[model samples]
Target: MSDVNLATIDLNLLNVVATVLAERSATKAAVKLYVTQSAVSNAMKRAREVFGDPLVVRESYGLTPTTRGAELLPALRAWLEEARRLVAKAPVFDPRTSTRTFTVACSDAVAIALLQPVLRLLKKWAPSTRLRLLTLDRLIAGDGLARGEVDLLIGIPPVMPPGLEAELVYRDPLECIVRRDHPQVRSKLTLSLYASLPHVDLALFGDIDDTIDRALARHGKAREVAVALPHFSSIPLAVLETDCVATISSRIARAFAARMPLKVLEPPLALEPIEIRQVWHRRSETDAAVGFLRSLVREAAG
Candidate 1:
């Protein structure tokens, strides 16, 4: 290690370093800091000399941190963040009047099933709060949460990526759904009957397929997929139109059955219950606005 004393380090250089690391681009960091690109470049050169590392290198669209750069990021970020919190002016969040937009990642089913209650609450309590709903597909939900692209994610918990925190929001068992007047549903659906019936499969994030398929295989059966859709909302419609049964979350099934002609039945096999969770990045964990949004989701989900 170089014997460079801490007192010799310029604290402003640390700010530039942190901004570059956060944005991964000198141009972007300059825009964020309201400085010219050349000024950011000059600061970066100084940071490289002081740190004795070529911290960032050019990549396709921008810069990526080298190993040494990556190692310094967390500590530098924490220090700068604390300093800002201590010295910078704080902004107040007046939910009743502030026009703040909160972005959320969730499937169409979740949006349809849960957002109404939250919206009604927002209308009454925080009239100026706006919501932007983004689709949660594949593993993008976890990535979005980690990158702070979305404020929160609501869905089943698989494996989450790094820098994200998840909390169980609700739990519901999977249920078999069919048209209200379907012939097979007239009697209690046994294992054999369920396996024999045509199925409408809804594969959200392309994950549930393996688990459901493995369970069916253990019973010496497999579903004859009459329709394959990417969302849960279409499952009920397919089941009602064709002689097909669907395995879906109980909350969705129940909500659909209340208005549409559908019946929810107990699944033949003992499968694991579905656990839906709300996920967000650790950076937003202590933010007051995010806390209020999380509370709204929890209350609405209830």
Candidate 2:
């Protein structure tokens, strides 16, 4: 009926009025609110001024809602209940019962080295949890992690993008892999022999294959790469079928050697170890579900 200054209103007055209407008596409402009856009467007077309604009336029985109070009670009760739920504490993660889908982006090497143990742990602990994997692409990886399209990123990037946090999972040194019955290679690789053999070059990260070429160029030698593959998983099979030697990571090389007729040999020249790390946006730092998945990845790496 008139303009009111909402800033001057006390929300506790509404709670008092609602309680009084429910209890049907100031004395009883005051007891329920842990306040004196005078406080309840004062609250009802302020509520009448705010709402412009005689919210309740004394009756022969006890107290009865006026026509306006009847219309307001249901709405007030619903609003208060919703407000309570809005501020309620979040529920803890229960892996066995939760059917959450976690997304991860990584290279084929990481998938080969870590996915098995991660799957085993998931099966035992969180059977219903599903895993979605994406092939690593650096162009959109940082943005994907920031926007939450990708849950976790596991890779060997030289540096993480801004606003992302990373932790080292493990380091795997470079090694030479060839078929077990290779013609020229035997127990170990010498610089001259390694340079002469046809190579299967792996280019997972952009220009990453250049590291080997650069290292070789320093010694006034170069590798003759017969074929270049984009993924480490492809190198083992290619090497197994031909006389090609692939300079590959130790973990994937050893893994392939166990299953296929491949040999993992130490390289003659020094190569830097691949530092694999897991990265995430700081926004998910406190998310229990994402934390659970991150823990599983660390366990798998170990």
Candidate 3:
């Protein structure tokens, strides 16, 4: 409330006052600020004169804030919080209207599993950003991920090419799902009964070369594949209406069962866990739009 010129006053002096109030001792404040105790004392003395109040009074053990200083503490803390947030936020990215476009490479399996939730996130966050999906046949290795044609990839791959950033999107263990009214599966699915059932096999994503069937073969057990489909999305529907059982990753199975008349059952075989990852090129590490999209993907997957 002084009539002094604002420009003449160092705003940084307010930081010193806040620090002293927090520490309750000039000696502690000086240690924290890497300045001498005399400097803190001088700043406080000036602050007292400027405010026309004893900002700190010497007590037997240390110092305590006077009435005016105590009254100002809450405002000072709030100001610090606001200032920190303003400094920490990214200046370039604004998801609500960003127009950045990115191409993501993945399999139809991933599309079937994650597309809906991811699209919902896009609508809520980066509404204007364009997402182009590249299927399995289109994926290839090229330049560093950050500088490549594929901005993001979400699926199981034989190799996580170097120079790319990747992390687990979701881990889906194998499980069997069948129609609720399945006659053969009245109760527990024993190994022999599982092998007897005609299974709906998803041929997409290189199932021929994948290890699931091979693992079953290793155990001297295999199921009769009566129906072969392109992707997992159709397999769930086929399974919901017919006696054909499908072995799918728990993630997609759970999602399908949540709405369909299907029931999840533990598979007899100890299948390896399925892993989906969010992979992006390292080149896009500093791209604000790409980073925001990655966050949305993570949130959706969670």
Candidate 4:
């Protein structure tokens, strides 16, 4: 045989040959391959010229493969099968066996309210997988996602970074937290009483451009921020020690209330609930592992 140069050959002709041989009729092969009967005939003509053989011959009842055609059948089918496997979509992610370490970026408060539950679900479903939680910075969040530094972003940024896709995980309503035995506060809080008390603010970012303050400003009222802490974990403890009342997310407030001697009460101001979203770059649109992680987060949020 002469040297078989792949660059000069139409591999599609081989598929035509395999189909014709299997079906034992050009008409049947045409139906299977979704092509006209003439197309199948033309493909056979080209194949005959390339291999220099009458690859198939017509018999009494139907078409029959020649010795050369029979030899080509197995090889052609094997190549087609391998080609299909090569072009197929990615396999489904198996959380039970996956060792993928997903990185999520969000505020410390979000980690407390959201990730704590996510961690429990992961522990049960994806025992081998790992999690890396990074502090959120809205300014650099988009870049981090594009760079593949973080797999997911979850938090309430005043402005979401452009070019990323987001879905609402849940809304976190604001609530006021104080020591259980706060002197001035009882069952209900009035706007005037709320403004009169000292406040303990949790500043995720260094600057304290908070929603609570903005809401208070709309009502022509303001509270004295006795202390501003950068971490969410410290706010509950700070409230426990002093008479300062902190307005925080209802999720975090109730969570801390269950453990500490803290009281969770509705905030006096009509502040909008914080929208927590799960964000990711469009590049990971079809990534199985990332999709699995997102599903777990959705479950946790619910």
RMSD of 1: 13.9
Model 1 is weakest, by summed lDDT over 10 consecutive residues, at 137-146
Q: Could you give candidate 2's per-residue lDDT for residues 186-216 as a string of tens digits?
A: 8988899988888898766544468888888
Write one digit per residue (lDDT tens) for candidate 1, span 3-27: 7688988779999998999899998
Show the lowest summed lDDT stretch of 10 residues, model 2: 135-144
Q: What digit string (tens of lDDT, one per residue) describes model 3 on residues 1-302?
A: 44789897876678888899989999999998899999998998888876789888999999999999999788888887888888895667788878878788887678767789999988887789888888766666443354577778788766766777788888888899999999889667888788778888777744543465677787788767777887668888888767888888887788888999898998877788888988887777897777877788888888
Q: lDDT scores for all predictions?
A: 0.85, 0.87, 0.81, 0.88
| Among all candidates shown, the one with the greatest TM-score | 2
Error of 1 at 41 (Å): 34
Q: Rank the candidates by lDDT, best first.
A: 4, 2, 1, 3
Instruction: Estimate TM-scores for all models.
Output: 0.69, 0.80, 0.62, 0.69
Off by over 4 Å in 4: 1-91, 138-142
Question: What TM-score does candidate 4 get on C-alpha atoms?
Answer: 0.69
Residue 297 of model 4 has an lDDT of 94
* Model 4 CA lDDT for position 192: 96
